[model samples]
Target: MLKSLPMLLLAILITSIVGIIIISIYQIYVSTVKQNKFNVIKDASITVIDRCGSILPYWLPLLEGLQNFGQQILPDYPFSLMSLYKKTLMPFVIVYVTNPAWAFIIFFILYYLFVRPKSPIPNRPFIRFNVLQSILLFLINSLLGATFRALPIEFRTSLYGLMVCNTLFWFVLLTIIYSVIKSIQGKYAKIPVISQAVRIQIDNQS
Candidate 1:
């Protein structure tokens, strides 16, 4: 009873914290939308979405299609390996993408507290690589969203740039998803430029 009591309290505390964060975000989003401050919210929202949306290919069929693009270009195995992805991964990914602001805050807090020390888990190459990858991706997405915002609304809304953005989005998304899956399976994806940068950061930390 005593041990269970502490666990119950901890769970309640976590739930309360999460609820508060969500409420705060909801309020901010509502205020921004209501006050006609779309630009401010749009940049932040799209940046987070682009950063985390990379994980969607693992769960989304359209994204998975993009990842297995070669199958479409060539006669190949009619079955998609992505279908074999663990079903348990979807709920977590969906929640993260849907509430990216909250997800990022919660993940950053947990990572800093439990994974950022000289702990052996922190030293793990795969974990370090992914952390760096996520950070870089976030920065890239931020810049991209900001640049998009600078363009005229008509241009932004036009189908002219849609194809380019769509292609780039899926490319980055699938690449990250592939790396994540490989990491989970105890392998490295070894993406060229990104992998090199991740290695440098991990080495410097070590």
Candidate 2:
């Protein structure tokens, strides 16, 4: 366990780093999109100003000033690719990966009903428990995320709250990946409650 401590810490650190990077990237991308929208509005106004110069002589300069003011005050908001990615694609992927609502249902039905204890596979027990623990972790993360989401948007969007939530998400994801690798190597991952539950179920089956 002492020798593995560093590996565990590294896994967690990697997870946290990934979360930070993704969040930072998301913020940067969104900001870029907003700026782009504002720029587009300003450019369109300038184009109108130029066209009005040829069509209207006396009002051209006044219209140009008003259009410039409007560009500053009422910039048109375009549909950003970042918004689409963050709101639609990211959520779908996150739900599929982190939420065990569907995974748990499918895995349990398949594992218990079809996978027998006396299977010839040498690593069957380890694989079974690994999957169980992974599912449990996913459920825990999903619930945690949901609970955070239930908070007021003001708090949920705060830096501190976002950091905490991201850290949890990253930690669970990295830990699950690490656990899977260990199981493939015929090692038992010592996840506290879930591991104990897996052990109990295994013994009862045996």
Candidate 3:
């Protein structure tokens, strides 16, 4: 019994040490970046208009994602808001994506009204960043859709196409959702690659 007790004590001691090390590492990570350190945090200093402005732009990508790949993800379930949205709102999104004139009108409005360097209506950095990010997302999804269309019909209809579409759908959906949530919380969504590009472009213009 004493021999077994020594082994048990050693096992517990090792476990305790390992646990402490893991907790220390976790604390370090949290201390360094766990509170979304890279993201811009909005507080009382930020206005309601700026926060609200940031949120609406994300819908462009959200709708674009839905228009392109929603059916595959959210099948027509009865009484689903998505189903309703697909029925009511998808046609307009389809027009926005397909008709350059309609899209251009929107782009003209947003570019002139919000993100442009010298706009009549004043804009906030948070609003401008979110709007630009949304525009970038829209452009990306458009390019991807066009590229897919250029591929041979066989490839477009193959398992590989499904995989690509699914991946893109998640990318657009998740990124926009994250951005929207952050905007709601008055923070910038610092998504890799995209956010950096948006920041660089905005900084250059500024």
lDDT of each: 0.46, 0.45, 0.69
Question: Looking at candidate 2, what is the lDDT of residue 144?
Answer: 60
Once superposed on the true structure, which residue ranges of model 3 sit more than 4 Å away at CA? Answer: 1-42, 71-100
Candidate number achieving the greatest TM-score relative to the actual structure: 3
lDDT of 2 by residue, 1-206 (tens): 34434533443355455545544464465458855766422222222212211111111112222222212222223548445545533433334344424344544553563245764444444445554564555456556656766778787557676566556644654565556444322356787777787678777877
lDDT of 3 at 55: 65
lDDT of 1 at 37: 59
Query: Candidate 1's residue-wise lDDT over 1-206, tens digit each?
Result: 33334533444455455435544565566566754755433223222222222222222222223322322222223335334332423333334344446434534643573246465442344444555566555555545545655777676546655544555556656765666455333344577786688677766767
lDDT ranking from best to worst?
3, 1, 2
Clashing pairs in 3: none
Q: Which stretches of candidate 2 lie over 4 Å from their true place?
A: 1-105, 114-123
Per-prediction TM-score to the true structure, in the order listed: 0.47, 0.45, 0.70
Q: What's the CA RMSD of model 3 in angstroms?
A: 18.7
Ranking of predictions according to TM-score: 3, 1, 2
Q: How many steric overlaps are in each model, in order?
A: 0, 0, 0
CA lDDT for candidate 2? 0.45
